[model samples]
Target: MIIGTAGHVDHGKTALVKALTGVDTDRLAEEKRRGITIDLGYAYAGDLGFIDVPGHERFVHTMLAGASGIDTALLVVALPEGIRPQTREHLQILSLLGIEHGVVALTKADLATDRVADVTVQMNELLSATPLAGAPMIPVAAPTGQGIEALRAALLASVPAARGSGGHPRLAVDRAFTLSGAGLIVTGTLVSGRIAVEDRLVLSPSGLELRVRGLHAQNQPADHAVAGQRVALNITGPRLSRDMVTRGDWVLHPAIHAPTDKIDARITLLPDFRLGPDSVRGPDSFRRMAPGAHALRQDAEVHLHLGAAHVMARVSLLDTDRLEPGGDALVRLTLRQRIGALARDRIVLRDTGATRTIGGGMLLDPFPPRRGRRTPPRLAQLAALEAADPIAALTGLLSVPPGWTDAAAFLRARNVGADEQLDFGSFVRAGGLFLLANTFDRVRDSIVAVLGAHHRAAQELPGLQAERLRMALPDRPPVAGFRGILDRLLDQGVIAQDGPWLRLPAHRISLSPQDERIWAAVMPLIAGERFRPPRVRDLAQALKLPEAAMRMTLKRLQRMGKVTEVAPDHFFLRETMAEMAAIAAATADADGLLTAAALRDRLDNGRKVAIQILEFFDRIGVTRRSGDVRRMKPDWPRLFGGGG
Candidate 1:
């Protein structure tokens, strides 16, 4: 387990670690000269790793980088100083980061032995409403070996056993340096999974691949290290330099690839959070009022801290425009830079202008739905996601009305367990830039119902066009999203497609009994005319039928592929069009070029009808017209399934 020290500056946090482990964590010359910790320091006691952080106000960002991944905290309070400004801020930061187990040490006991009891009372009162309210307070003096052994025992007893989930390994680099003969060593707490020597790791945000040359756990050489241990990795690779890999970067498994610039989260304002001047009615009144008396207005700018990454962001409250202090609200954070983070990761928010921590929360969705983000349904979905487990949330989001989602985006936003990912692999289907699943029966059923209605309404048509079918659906997804669902349906044999049209797999175009009679009567007249068939008005005149009826019958025949409409007013049997195409190909010269005159003689038809047929060929890509000559396209033979 990793234990981090938190308290005011010069409060003996580093001194306490030195007394317990016999190693001075203050390795910097400036830190030694200034008599204060400026950066994060490290020491080890047997198997327990202690991260000693600077307690100065200016180094809070640096301190947060260390406290982000600790299992427990060692809050040190000086007996002489009691509770100071930084002491309260550090404790609040620890609570915000979700550090539950810790022990508060009243340092400098030798000098203020008489005041230890009084300091302990102040410490208890400070933690009364915080996560560490019931934690044990031990009075210890770093010098002269006073209460040191008891402090060590208390830390060991309070630290929980490390449980490895066997997920992908991720290490947030806190320090990077080049050691003699070692080259490019980075130290950080292993957040999850395990890493062994010679293992390949990828540095995120940079996307550079590196191999682990060596490993150290708690300052001792080791072949492998697991989660919850402070480790140093000796890394070597091409183009690798100490400057390239720095603090706040991540070394993670290659399989973990999702990085995001926006996230949906559930945020809680601290009780002492203060709104800016713009949010208040009067500046004087705001200055006189106590903290936690106001609410965070919409579109407030803040600094966001997740893992070791610090970024500027804007908050958009989803449930309400104003968020009261100590109240929880679902919000969206638009980040200024991309960060490697996943859902359920804890994030701390601070006011941008004041740099004081306002609140912290857990990431709900790293990639939220861009459309309808502020709708009531979307708000409800986010709430459900906040309440569900990772696996359940993933499945629920995939089962949305769209029935498809970007695989990379969905996987990146969810922190799925290794076991759950392995179990649910088959449930997710991949098609056309999306991860599809039939988990939502309603979406599937709706698609089938819509296709059935389309087929029933247009019985004479071959199938419903893709765009038309999309419009008919209740929940109209984007074109790509609709295609993904259609592809899945086609794969399942629930739907069939003919060129640009979609239909039920069992659907077929058959004329009704009444229309079949009309078709039978019109076939002879159309076939007799062949290349120069009668127009709709001429056909109705000859058959003594209504013009609308004649046109409807011809349209049905066209849908059945038994007739072809070469021009606006001309119609021909399918066999005649194929015959005309063969004649046109035969009449071409060695260059495979023909003219209307050549085809007119071959078909023995008028110039107008011949020109119409040639233009029809051009429209279907069967022939290309240049000046006065028509050239046979390469695929002309396949155009009508006939030989040249």
Candidate 2:
């Protein structure tokens, strides 16, 4: 487990660490001369890794960088000072990051021996509402061996067991440097998954692939490292240098390659934060404004800290126009630069000046929907996401009807199981749209119901057109998703597709006795007038049938491929249209160009009939029309079954 040190400046945090581990964490000359921690420092106690962070207000960003992967916090307080401003601020930060397990060390016990009882009362009041409210407080002094062993024992008992690396490997680099013998080394807590020697890992946001040359767990060389352990890795790859990999960068598995610039989160503003227009007017105005008068209004610019990365972002409130102090709301953070993030990752939000941490929250969706911000459906979805696990949240967002998402987005945002039991292709169909297994089943059932109704209503028709079938469904999937469902159903022999229509596998068009009599009369008339077919009115008059009945009969024939409608009032037999196509192919020149007059002369037809036929050819991609002349398309031979 990684133990992080949190406290104010000159609180004997570094001195207390030396007493327990026998190693000094302040390695910088500036820090030693100044008598304060400057940057992040590390020390080890057996299997426990101590991340000793700076206690100064200015180095809070650096402190946050180290706090991202810590399992427990060692909150240090000076007995003489009791609870300082930095101490309270650090506690709030630890609470924001959700660090629950910790031990509060009351340092300088030797000097404040007579004040110990009073300081303990103050410490309890300070931590009453924080994450470490009930944590044990031990007094220790570095100069003398006072309560040092007790502090150590309290830490060991309070720190939880290390979690196993069950997901993809991700190590956020808090420090990167190069050694003479070791090419490049990156030190950080192994946030998740196991990394072994020679395992290939990619640097996210840069997408550079590198191989692990060596591993060090808790200052000892090891062949493999697991999650929740502070580790150093020697890395090497093409064009790789220590400068390219630095603090705020991530060494992650290749599967997590997508970087997001927007995140949906549930945030709570710190109670002491002011809420009003004066808060955002400027730094001068903010300093002049009353503490409780300022608010974090919508569209306010701020700095977002997640993992080890600090980015500029704008806060867009989802449910409200502004957020009051201590009030919680759903929000969308639009980041200025992309970062590697996932659902449920703890985040801290700081003011634009980066001076103080205003609030923080849990990331609910790393890639949230871009529309319907204030709508009920969108709000409900976001609320559900806040209460769901990573896998459940992913499935819920993907299962929403009628859109495709980036496959990499979903895969990268998932907190677990990229290469485990989840089959991405199974739930997500082609075109990168995610469909849950249950969603696919629901769509399939809807299709079956729509087709069944169509068969009952229009038995004389061959089947419903594919486009019509899609429109008939009450809840339609995305176009590609619908097509994928059709393909699956066809492969399973649950449905049959004929040309451009779909039907049940056993469905076949059959006319009733009355319709069959009407078909017999209509067939003879259409066959005799092959080239110059009668209109609906003329056919109805000749057959002594209603025009509506005649038009319905002609439509069924057209669907059955017995007749073709070339224009609004024109009709032709299938054989006649085929003959005309053959004649056009024979008469056209090398360019496949022909005039309406030439076709009319070839078929002994009027100008009106020739024009209609040419238009029909153009519609089906058989021919291209230029000026008054028509030219067969490049693929006319294949479409018309004619020699080139």
Candidate 3:
């Protein structure tokens, strides 16, 4: 398990890590001389390890990059300066990031009296609503080696035994450097995945491919490493250097995973930053940051520092206006800019002015949906993430995008996966094919509904048009998706199709009382003399039907061969098609010859339709040769009449 250190500057964060592991975190010359950590430092202890981050304000951004993947936190407070600015800020960050296991280390206990008990009370109050509420508070003096063993024991106990790390390797590089002999070495806690020697890998954001040259844990070489293990990897590849690889860059399997810039996260603000509307804002905040802003508000604007990139973002809060102390937030951090991120990565946020660490949280989505201040259901959608099970966690995040019909492939494209076992509440039957848990019955119901609508109007009519299907489900998946859904419905005998239309297997059009009115007053005017037929308005008035509804019914009737519509206001019976076909065939050629122009003028059709007809005839050898005034081929009868 990874243990993270947080407190004010010179609070012994480094000393504590070193004392526990006998490894110094002050790798930089400036840090030792300045007597303050300006960069991220690391070390390991028996089984517990840590990331010792800078506590000064300016380096809060650096601290954030180092704050990720820590399962346990050591909130260090110097006894003399108990509960300083960064102290409060770091605790708030830990809370937001969901560091459930932690212990308070009060340094220089000898310098303050037992009255320093007040400090622990203050610290507990700070953690009140956070995951670490009521955790152990230990006072220690590194100089005297006081309470050191107790601190170590607490950490070891806090870190749970490692679970399955047999999947892909996810190495988040918080520290990258070149050893004297080793070309490039990136060090970080192996958060959740594993890696092996000589395994091919890639650095994110740039995706520069490389090979793992070597591996180590706590500065010593290791054959392999697993999740929750603090390990250093010796690597080499093109353009692989400290500059090319910064903190937050992941060393993982090549095609298995990539980074994200826009993400969904759970965040909370620190108690101390004092960020009011007047506070200086960062470039990433879409809107201003006000004072007393304690919660991650829905649609609230903020900045996200992911990996090496910074982005302007909007917040999607879980359920409340404010996250009281330890309360959690289900927020979507929509970035105006792009950054490299992976699912479930942790991040830190700071005030643009003082650059103080305000809060940080774990990213649940690399590309989260944009919900501009929606209803409570949206917030509830995010609240279910705290549960274990990756599949369940993903299913909970399922929501339709604005103007979308379903959400499966969209989720898949973003690398979201569900357990084969979890089911979505909506199904194809409910017009929710994108949901994971939908059953076949739901799919059948959806098909039946569409077919039923068509059958009720006219059993002999074709199903709904493809475009109509698309429009009706403007918010569902896509129409091209219907084929697969229909296939399932057909297999279940829920629906059938005639031509382009759909229907229930046993269903047919059975016109209602309105149909009797239409049939009695119509048909006569349309069965013959289809060309230049009576006006549709006259037909509607004759049938005593509303003009618009009449037109719809007539179109449906005509499609079903109950009536034939020849013009915009005129329709003809299907039976008249034979005579019309003969009229068309007679005009095709004269003296056993045909011309493209003759076909156009005789048919009085547009260029496109005329060309289409002529092309069909030509392809069938109905007109060929004879210097473009085409002679009728032997197949003329077959092409124009028999075959048609």
Candidate 4:
């Protein structure tokens, strides 16, 4: 279990830590001069991990960063200083951080006299409304170790048992840097989940995927790390820099968790500041945080502490703009920096103006649904976001791209688990833009709708070519993304094609009225005959129509399935093949030798059309190749109603 220490500067917090671990926590020169814990320091005893934090007012942000991931807190108030400016502020921060399991450490007990009762009473009054209110308050002296053993016992007893859910590893990165001896290293409390050496990882909010090069806990190598334990990690991959990453970053499983920028929270302000302890309002009073406010918005410009990351954000009040002190209200905060914040995570709010403790709230949405500047609906969405099934909630609000999900990363925002829809090898062939299965269905339906409408507009056209319809998609990334999905649809029998042309299998182009007229006249003129049909020029003259109009009619006739071309200038009545069948039957000899000229004699209408039909028959395998002539297949007599 992880525990943190909080108190005023020179309150003997470091001395207490040293007494607890026998290791000096002050690592900075400035801190040694002043003899104060200027930054976060670390130590541990057995399974209980310790985070030593600075109590100086100037180091509150540092304190927050240190205290963020611990399961318990140790509130230290010196016996003589009982409650200084930072003492109350630290208490407020603890309250905002939701540190339910903690002990109140009353240090410098050696200086206490009969006045101890008064100081204790005052401490109790100050802690009344905070998480430490009912905690055991033990007075101890770090120099003489007056109450060290009892303090240790109280710390172990006060903090609850570790979380045993043993799910995936969720590491909130508190410190990350390249180690001189071990390469890349990161440290934080392993909130839940486990990490083994060489396991793959994805750092979230920044979304960098890497592998765990090594692992450690309390400066020693560890085989595997688990939830509720403080851990240090050595990782290697791209984007390994202090600037590339920072505190509050998440060491995600890649299979779980999504990064979000918006969150709806129920903020509560602590009652320790001068902002009228009684007038300290909840998150709902954040809207008045706008610039140039009449009353300085202490809760206005909030330091939103979600997970292990602390970000600045503007708060929108849920109840009222200016809230009464100690009042509670749910509010929405928009962050200025991105981090690994998810729905339902606890968030501590720090008042930027006074740099004091405000309160903590639960994240309603990992990525909140933005609805203009209105606060009510966003609050409602946050409520949904905090539901038991947060992933389902995300799906309800997700606007995913269409097609088979190619990579699992794209569907993270929808909370699609690897075990859910996509696993090892289910190819999502949305062209190259594969998305999740459901996303692909959405794309296919939308494409079909648009294409079907286009089909109806020009019955003479097969369908909107795939290339053409792809242009209509929103933003139109590329057709490659849609390819995998199209193939799936084709296999499902939802779509069909004729050679290179795609169309609904049940669809056949129909002729327009004037085109139908042209078709009827041309049908008989060509009849059981095959030859290059007249040029559009001669045909228009024969039909007394414009050449362009006649040309359009011929194209329309082609779409209507009434004609086919055997040569560049050729056209054939759909019935021409039948006449070729009859002629080939009469002219064939016993040896299957039949002259092209003999077949031409039977049609008599023309040699060109007859030979064309025979050649068409040969191309289709209805007539077999025999020397220079063509012969009907043996089954021709019964199949085509003719005898040899």
* Highest TM-score model number: 1
Cα RMSD to the true fold for all candidates: 8.7, 8.6, 11.4, 14.4
Error of 1 at 55 (Å): 0.7
Task: Score residue 179 of candidate 1 by CA lDDT.
Answer: 85
Per-residue lDDT for 110-191 in model 1, tens only?
8998998888888889999988998998889888888888988888889776756566788888899988988899999888
> Deviation in angstroms for 483 in model 1?
4.7
Counted clashes in each candidate structure: 0, 6, 26, 35
TM-score for each prediction?
A: 0.76, 0.75, 0.66, 0.64
TM-score of 3: 0.66
The sequence of per-residue lDDT tens digits that candidate 3 reaches over residues 1-644 is: 77889988988888888778888888899987998999887777655667889999777777766776677889898888878878877776676666788888888887785746798888788778778898888888887788899988877778755645644576767777788977788887676556788888887767888888789865567778887777788888877767798766777766545455456667656544345454434454345546666544445555466543455566655456555544556666666645566555566766535355556677655555455434665555545444345556545544322212234423332333332333444433223344443433444455567557757765566556444654554243445455456555556676665433455667656566877667766777654434334567877887777899878878767665455444455555544443434444566555766666766676565545455545544554455655666555553332212321
Best by lDDT: 2
lDDT of 4: 0.67
The clash tally of candidate 4 reads: 35
